[model samples]
Target: MKIQEIREIIKLMDQSTLDEFVFEAEGTKLKLKKHNGETRPTVHTSAQPQEQPAAVVTPKTDAPKVEAAPAEPIEKQESTSSEASSSYKTITSPMVGTFYSSSSPEADSYVKVGDRVNADTIVCIVEAMKLFNEIEAEIEGEIAEIHVKDGQLVEYGQPLFSIK
Candidate 1:
């Protein structure tokens, strides 16, 4: 019924082995199905009567590939400068959204390279459906790299930061 409840259902589905889930409450119906192994699940919701088509809310998990842009150069530079032997864990986006480094444009970024973070640390915000969700590090480590640029439209599960 609420966004939090829906999010919890998604989280549970992701962690479990089930590939599909359907629920009907009151007059509303919800159906969630995961596609490919690496893809985010799709959600379909509809009210009774079935006159109108069911509303499908699919996250923008993939974008059309385009030619190299100016931003690629910076990413290349960062990758090249990093040590080849460094071992790190990447923090990926849990949902598709526009990635923001700070709560506001004037505020300092939540984390940067060389900054240590724990599971509770809010490293960034992902704005979806006009709601800004704070994304946590979920692991204990020092940030080693940032893979996405600020204000970039990111895909679900896309790497955001690497930690060591």
Candidate 2:
């Protein structure tokens, strides 16, 4: 793909909740990732031909750089779940894909906090390979929390919702 096309994809990813994106066509592959809330995304490209070297593209314009604060040692906090909180069960994503809280942008979410659900309840939709798959809440209880936002990319076994 052309650098301009890759730049456009980066722009779209920045607007969405996606942190990383991988695209492969023919024998070329492109991967982009954003880190530490940086405005510019890092790009990596690879070609199938073993002798062909990958290219790294950097923006031409000079941007102001802000120095990051010194890292501080993180202190671990003890888990303090009460009996009520301990009873909550998490509904995890069954596949790696984008999570949609509703069927469409104009539609209401399938489930929300304080909503009761059962095994047959369609909690959300996970889109993979352009196919939208309805995700069912296998546990019976009230939704304690919605762990993921709409259009967020989720991995297999990632917590999507909590029930109690």
What are the per-residue Cα lDDT tens digits for candidate 1 across 31-138? 777777432544445555333323333333454423322121112223543453457778888776899999999999999989999999999999876778899998
For every model shown, the clashing-pair count is: 0, 0
Cα displacement (angstroms), candidate 2, residue 8, comes to 31
Model 1 regions lying over 4 Å from their true place: 1-81, 84-86
| Pairs that collide, model 1 | none
Q: Would you give me the overall lDDT of model 2?
A: 0.69
Local error of candidate 1 at residue 152 (angstroms): 0.4
Model 2, span 1-164: residue lDDT tens:
54645565666566655555554444566766667644464444445533332323333236433333322322333224343366778888766699999999999999988899999999999987676879889789998778779999987568888789
lDDT of each candidate versus the true structure: 0.70, 0.69
lDDT of 1 at 135: 92
How far does residue 2 in candidate 1 sit from its true spot (Å)? Answer: 16
Name the lDDT value of residue 11 in candidate 1.
70
Stretch of 10 with least lDDT, candidate 2:
70-79
